[model samples]
Target: MPLKSPITVVATSLLAAQALAVSVHNWWDVPSDFGNIAELQSSIRVPQGSDPIKTYWMANGFGNGYMGMQHNSDTERRILFSIWDDGQGSKVEPIRHGDNVTVGTFGGEGEGAQSYLVYDWKAGDTVYFRVQANVNEAEDYAEYTGYWGTDGQTWNLIASFRAEKQPYWLLEPYGFLENYGSDQSEIREGYYGNFVMINSNGQHHTPENFQFTHTDIFNEYREVWDQRLVEQGKEVYMRIDGPADQGAYPPAHH
Candidate 1:
């Protein structure tokens, strides 16, 4: 079945008052590998600012088992990476030491090599590093695919490729469905809306703008659900909220 057209809904209460700046790009583009080694590095010369800087990296596991980082150090000579084996899952955290920390090979099966890392800055800091790799096998594409979180533990969705085209992809926060409990009768009686759409561009338009073009898209989608409900002698209602505040992710380094 066609996946439900992806939708992003944000709660008003969670919106932030200030706008944040974010810039993303791929730093490494190479053939996926099983044993061949590669290094992805970047340097952001820290400028003067009070914002904390945060860096993130992840492997997409295309032709390789997974992506891992090694030998990470800041100008301050601090060990940002750590190696640990939790028995349940063995991987590096913060940063890993030793020249021998090896990431497993993906055995050349599905997506070749995919991974990514991001650096969040407060305002004027420069950071740089080389993400090195050790590969044994190789594939065609090695685009980065991963997400980072405010805390190391919980992560939000960052980006992913479209199923077939593979050329088209999207980047946004993870979405969720709001469940209105057992009151089936209440489904249509009061305010009943299934989804919310957020335009990251922050451009708000009236119903007329939507009626001419963008508006028709949602109307069509709503019609589909309405038809199904009507067939069952049920009632369904949908409401489109404003270009509500789409909260920004925490700055990478603040």
Candidate 2:
């Protein structure tokens, strides 16, 4: 059968007026027929405005948590990855930790386990991320592992989580840029591309295309901020600027 075009979704909600910036999102809805996705890899770089706190370059995002680098604080940076729990209150089970990873449980957005490593990551430095999972849909479970590094360097193992009921594969990929800080006045941007997936049958693929979208929380203060997600073949640019009194994540800014 021929592959079908992927779908894009724009999530909307209310946010504090003019205080926090809206989260921008992008998706490459690559469906899988070959088999369950065994692994996925991609890269990202921030050529400008990477110094602000709560600026998350979510290079790998999905239905639940995300994986990428963040400006968590003025003095701290991290390679963060997390996956949600099974709704029945089954938290993510810890499987492994690389070298200096911190593993803990998280809530608020969703219940799940999270892992991170503090590194002095800088702007304009391209970082690569790869996620592989041992999935068993028949058993309705999976164990996911995330790794990160630069070219020609050993892949740094972030951590792994054994999901009891959260069976997942990297078939549908979502990446986004978010300015979670109170100051939405700053401009933030990123370049995301080279999305490749390896299937359970050892097939490798590059998604046919991608789409850009934002939230649906409508407000008159929408004009105070703007977000653009432009796709250039295999790569896409995610940018956000703001200070809107109240707004939403826009759509079709490709």
Candidate 3:
């Protein structure tokens, strides 16, 4: 049987401190058609002195997308996160990519040409974000990162992910959910539970299924992080409760 949800409380102390004062922008609001024309030319904004350290973009070919980071000498260190939607069923998969490496193959189609970049970044650094399409032909969309509650309907935008030289960046309504450990196995008997089951229709979750709680004080950590982002002028994206557009990304890029 599935284990019960861990009894935990989320805190907002730490989050309040690290928050930035920035507004999320819509991806369609930015310009497009700036591939390889400039370094960081999307709707997003990064402070000076720091270059783009990492980039996530769609594979021009056909397998999975790519993630890339820049070195001191402006060289790139890239890796493939996974093949075929980056192991996620989402419209866009965050895959890793770099030079001459055949990361993997897509479920269907010929091959994927992944690409990305990374630059110099440091703690206390803040940058603007906007989500855009993988390619010019793909649909216009935005990228967002935030949190999800038990309801999973309301969502806020903690950060935006955008493409370089593009006019707009995707605006994700939810913040990033960092899940640690494997959900397949239970760490401790009553201390924690296994499995996190989400309803196919909504974000509704069950604790017994390991679908509602975290092992390491998730609530407190999340609250702290959320507060920090808010203090930084960043807002925590939350969904009130409803079905999100799961078909945002097109199949061509996947």
Candidate 4:
């Protein structure tokens, strides 16, 4: 249950040849045994990328799933954290609050709206993120907080908001790598480790504590290996190969 970016459409017509769609995600969802989650924290190596405007990675913690850390080709290669609300009913979108400034907003077609805040993060730095939830007793609401910093010792508050709808404490966390540009030569890589989720009752869970599954954008009828994940000891890593050889393996772990 990593954060899922809105899918991008690269081609509009069959005549468009090279403007094919491209995207990849590696995810690990919280199992039913994990129960209600209070907070999730992880240290992710900012991927080495050639084009800052075309390739990116996100290490995220999901609450009510629509929230967590984000790094994309947009916003000039800065880090972002966002909170989202279901885009239907009496819920107006959550407004930006706290010390975090708004970087962007996304919502449409009956989907929830996401308000993102920016941070100065460079590639190759080991950035840590934490997504935690709290309840406002007066209003009987859920507040989600996002934090980020170098390593995991110190954390800077990034963003927080009260969900339009009360969110339960069940954080389903995941990580993903994507290359949106048409250039197939540029490769993006991220090493995700230290995945820890604290359940509502304050029980902590790690990658070593649960069984995981690997998923990719594949067409079983035609056969394609678009993306995947592999477990390296206690840590998990991801690879995004462009639509090509289904038999090609992920690049050796760095």
Candidate 5:
């Protein structure tokens, strides 16, 4: 069975301290003509036994189209990067079709990508993620690669896929921390940090290089590690907390 959803939250005592706050944001909106984003990278740490029944993708994007991670159950996780094609979602599949990674079909045949086993994720360990997109004009296809690592330097190729007629750069670069599960009287929180984006030209951009258009916070109910909690728009720090109504928006404070 897939792992529980990759979510976050805080305990009652922790909440009382006000030391824990949930925050999420849709940062800088990258233009589709940004000459094609070559690669994007980020890191996150989930505390031990801090599981909530929701999905959380530390970083995600969508413009003409997009790709990202979805936390299914504790055992089932996926690195999804897709483009609109053939009236169906053409996603990246796994390098291997076994445990840890496998082919997933949802909407129809060839609709899902590599599903991962995230429930076994080591507690307090920082996992690094990288996604690369390249255009293959000869075939008019866009190739994408998902890489992961633990040391923060060495990355293992997780999966690679191609989408037809998706040659344009994807827009909307943002970090997401969510508790899609409806867990009132509690908040799901995760630590997202060390974000970097590499354009097709190989130029690096960080929070220090851009302004973030903050979205997805509903006051005390939903918040981010912003000036109210930490340095604003630092990018190195972010959080998502709430009891989402149908796994989309956050609910009011309990």
Candidate 6:
């Protein structure tokens, strides 16, 4: 069984608090020329001061679902994987799941199945995430598998879900950071890099340039950290919350 994670995750928690917090999101897209992709792998490192409670640092997100790590309640940090319904009337079903992991249905943020492992993923440590699609044309569904680990090569199988109207590839891969806690001025940052995409035809692409996006919150709050572009758009830097408008070096810079 490949259910064990290469990096051991000890359970830990943060004192959860609530009030008012801004949700900041960013995206990275692969070159359109590469075309339909079957798998997308990336890493995220929420630096020392960047990781906060009630934060979700999404690494690999597609048209249907997303897989990443989250800072849940005071006693639980998780490696989470969630997927919404097929939208054409078929709900996503869990075909397989890892050990000591929770798998079930989730509502509110679109109805779907969700899974997570209570692993104490520390801030400043890099965690890698990957999502691969296995399409069954005859069945008219695809089994999408989620994996996470410290090293890019070894991965722990988070869960596998069957999504209806599932395509042959993971369409529109992206990454975003979200803070769900109530802290209006706390700095939340995530460095998303080391992007590797494999197309349906078995072509590999190492994408470096990532474009930035600002949500509607930026229009309302107008926080300086919400302003993303750092140096000539070579790196995609996203900071949500705080008054200072400063930039940092890209962790994925090679």
lDDT of 3 by residue, 10-88 (tens): 1121122124211111111112222211111111121232222222211111111212112223455332222122222
lDDT of 6 by residue, 1-254 (tens): 12221011100001110123344445555776987678888888787877768888888877677899988877889999987765335678898988888999976455678999999999889899999988676766778899999988899999999877554457666777766655646567877767888987889997665655444433434344442544442334566654454335322211
For model 1, residues 141-202, the per-residue Cα lDDT tens digits are 22222332333345433232212212111211211111112211111111111111112233
Between candidates 3 and 4, the lDDT winner: 4
Task: Candidate 3: list runs displaced more than 4 Å.
Answer: 1-114, 134-172, 177-254
Rank order (by TM-score, best first)? 6, 2, 4, 5, 3, 1
lDDT of model 3, residue 189: 9
**What is the clash tally of candidate 2?**
3
TM-score of each: 0.21, 0.81, 0.24, 0.68, 0.63, 0.81
The window of 10 residues in a row where model 6 has the poorest summed lDDT is 9-18
TM-score of 5: 0.63
Which regions of candidate 1 are displaced past 4 Å? Answer: 1-37, 53-79, 82-127, 136-254
TM-score, candidate number 1: 0.21
Model 6 lDDT, residue 70, Cα: 88
Comparison by lDDT, 1 against 5, better one:
5
* Regions of candidate 4 where Cα sits further than 4 Å from its true position: 1-21, 29-31, 47-52, 63-75, 89-100, 108-120, 135-140, 209-233, 241-254
True-vs-predicted CA distance for residue 153, candidate 1, Å: 33
- Model 4 lDDT per residue over 143-222, tens place: 77777778798877666666654544534455555554555544445566777788778888775543232232344411
Which of candidates 1 and 2 is the stronger one according to lDDT?
2
Cα shift from native, residue 81, model 3 (Å): 10
Which has the greatest lDDT? 6
